[model samples]
Target chain A: MRYVTPRKAAVGLGASHTGTEHHWWMTVSSAALALLTPSFLMVMGTALQLPERADILLYFTRPYPAIVVAIFMTLGMMHFIKGSRIMIDDYLEHTARKVAIIGFSIFGWAVIAFTLFALARIQLAFAQAI
Target chain B: MADVNRGNRPLSPHLQVYQLPLAAITSIVNRAAGQAMVAGLLLLAFWLLGAAAGGGLWDWADWLTRSWFGFLVLLGSCWALWYHFLAGIRHFFYDAGEGLEIETARMTSIAIIAGSVILTLLSLIIYWI
Candidate 1:
């Protein structure tokens, strides 16, 4: 069985190598994020504030819901970075302006990377934390 | 215009070359965000699959994600989100008949970029702690 290389299978990135290398990851992330926003907004809007942080965590941790939340956080972070890249390019008119914009973008990626580490830990260690 | 100064400027097929309207720029940004969100979901799927498969498949993913490079890519996505989230809101605003003027639209665009950066940093502080 042969698996396709990135160059071969990234049809979404064809002709021009943009927004295609991470197609599956991006699509799934968007879908999950798309599902999560409304739910989180609802949960945040009505709650009378939990007494303990851990309790709040516990409330969100039950199986399917927890999974959804995790997906939400991950996709939210991912989309932000890719989205920013486009935005930066839009307003940065000068060459230096573009560089500065891109530099800020790199920082965005940095934040996501660190946040993911936290997410991975929280998701995998769900049983032990409680 | 940036092009007014140069005699023969080499144009690199770019989005900036287009006479972009607020609607057009907003659409482009939304698509970028939509695509990236999709990537994030895919990454989550890998994690979920790993969690499901038991064995050590998921653990391997966990390990990679925790690695230096994986962390970097993930962080990039985080930024993508903060920016897109705001940009998405801007679109919603536009949909509601706001930021229609050229100046107002551009200002809103700038605001979206600045606000997203600020928010992304805030999340990192919380996450890092």
Candidate 2:
């Protein structure tokens, strides 16, 4: 058996081809999150401190906060779903892996859907007020 | 023919046989932190749903998140998020064939721990002030 070099693995020049793709996916997504997480945290951390519900809604009503939350949620959960699948593959066998993958996929998508919907509603409230 | 009935299990020695290195520790903790984030994300979904279907749900979620216990949980999750995030950045360098040397791995591991703590505390300061 031959060991694949990391360089070849990264560029898809390796004997086993799929590793490169997964590596790239995780790399790119993680890089995106590294940038987005701080901005997202600033927006969310402020919202977390807001005392009034109406104030919270008004805060998210702004375009930058709403857009950052939406993008961050989408990307973060997408990364989660993929990362979970990799873990499941490593530790699970047969039916267990299948069930876990499905469960995580649903959970990730559900979070994305609910978050985007809520952000949209908050923005709509602001629109009505103006 | 060789003895077919002989039980021969060729097993690779695992954690029990080897000392856990900093890199291994970081990798394991990263997986754990990812799982923690999933749980945190579930809580977030409930909060968002409360916001979307506001009567008193949003207020209730807000109340819980503002409570002392909720604050503690949020702080822990915040640490998890940051640790996982920094560890992830280290992994990117790994994938690019940059940080596999022993010293770099140790340095990055320490950075992940220190960076996460600093970032979490900074966020808290920003929140309070």
Candidate 3:
């Protein structure tokens, strides 16, 4: 019933030298998101209700909403990158898996960057106006 | 030595062989919900980018979101968000060595499904009000 070969057991290597780093990051990010999700939802929900584009822009200028969006988008996308990688690994193989993992990771980061840039632009505009 | 009888060893039934339990369905749905939320994130990005750019881009983005199709997509995203949130909580508890019992797990799965639906409806209702 020995699954490990004698020579292999002697060498004792495991899948990726990283070892639980992915799991650890996922756990930490998910825990943070559990706390952040409600506030993030509230911020987004409020922003959506604003009547005009200017009002929506002004809404994000507030400290609370801006901060919530910043943290949530950053951490949420990082969590997504990890989660999607696991999903891609499970269902995809070879070139498809590698391409998907790379593509999704890049996409996740691009979203985070653009969203944060937008938030920053809004805040800066508000600052210059007042 | 283990290899001697490997071919004769009975393996567990594959995924399609048996009816999936509530917990399994919940688990897979959680993954699906996570995937679905990506759409929501992209929409959010679009809105933010438009807001930053202003003018036509902003108006177009605004119109798109307010459209019926956009509303439907958002509604699904809202449900997915809540579902995935609850599922994350369930997994947290599981990691803490709680709620692993069959009946408890099943009850929690049902709760996750029902709770997400209620939360989504409540959010929408509040939004419309």
Candidate 4:
């Protein structure tokens, strides 16, 4: 049989072998989001009270609001994908697990793509208006 | 073989048997909230797409969201979002090898539930003012 060195074993791959990596990525994104989420709420919350149409467009056209929302959407979706994976693994088995993971992953990436596209379109509109 | 004695062995604690601790319950609820927010994200996408489409689409989204039922859903989602966010932060601390003690876990569990509610109310207050 093949052998892993003490150093390799110490890395703690665990049964799934990807546990640590997934944990670290989720942790880092979670930390980033912990900071970003409050700001995200503030941005969206402010935009909510603005007068319809013109004021709302003017608000989102600014770099800060657009950029903040974009980053938060991206990071938050990434975290959601991983978090959903863990939950799927816990409660699902066999074919269901595979199907749920695929479904959730596609859903997450689709949101990311759609949000980015919308933000870019907004930015383009803002630029053309100037 | 290892399986020889396992045939008659009792199963481990599971949903029907074990009384879950506060921290375990918090973690489970956090997962549920995360899953629920997936639906919320779809609504958010609908709003963004409406914004991009313009020509009254944005107005429609805003009108629907401001309706009483829609507003209630939004409030519930807001609570879930904040709760999941804080729970994520707490998990980060645990991942880093900190706050593993029982007392710490219990306190953090309570903190997450309380903090999320407070943050949700605070945001609503800010939105209204």
Top-scoring candidate (lDDT): 3
| Ten contiguous residues minimizing lDDT sum, candidate 1 chain B | B45-54
Predicted model with the maximum DockQ: 3
Tens digit per residue, CA lDDT, model 3, B1-129: 555656767778897787798999999999999989888878888888899889999989888887887788888998999999999999989988999999999999999999999999998997888
> Please, what are the lDDT tens digits per residue for candidate 1 over residues A1-130?
6699866767666654664554445555555664576564334222213433345345544655555555555556456565555565566767866786667566555545544554455455676854
lDDT per residue (tens digit) for residues B1-129 in model 4:
555666767789898889888999998999888777666566666667667778787778767766786667667778888999888888777867998898999999999999999989998998898
Higher-lDDT candidate of 2 and 3 = 3
Docking class of 4: medium
Write the residue-wise lDDT of candidate 1 on B5-67 in tens digits: 666777766676767775566658656655564454445445444443445865675566556
Report the lDDT tens digits of candidate 2 across residue range A62-124: 889888889988989999999988889899999998999999899899889989989888888
**Per-residue lDDT of candidate 4, residues A31-51 (tens digit):** 888888878888877876776
User: Residue B51 deviation, candidate 3, in Å?
Assistant: 1.1
Per-candidate RMSD, Å: 13.1, 6.8, 6.7, 5.6
- Measured with C-alpha atoms, the lDDT of residue A101 in candidate 1 is 62
DockQ, all models: 0.04, 0.52, 0.61, 0.53
Candidate with best TM-score: 3
**Chain A TM per prediction:** 0.53, 0.84, 0.87, 0.88
In model 3, how large is the Cα lDDT of residue B3? 54
Q: Score residue B102 of candidate 3 by CA lDDT.
A: 92
Better of 2 and 4 by DockQ: 4
A best-first ranking of the candidates according to their DockQ comes to 3, 4, 2, 1
Which residue pairs clash within candidate 2? none
Candidate 4 regions exceeding 4 Å error are: A1-11, B1-15
Residue lDDT tens for model 3, A12-127: 34475566677778888998998998898888888988888889989999899999999998998889988998899899999999999999999999999999999999989999
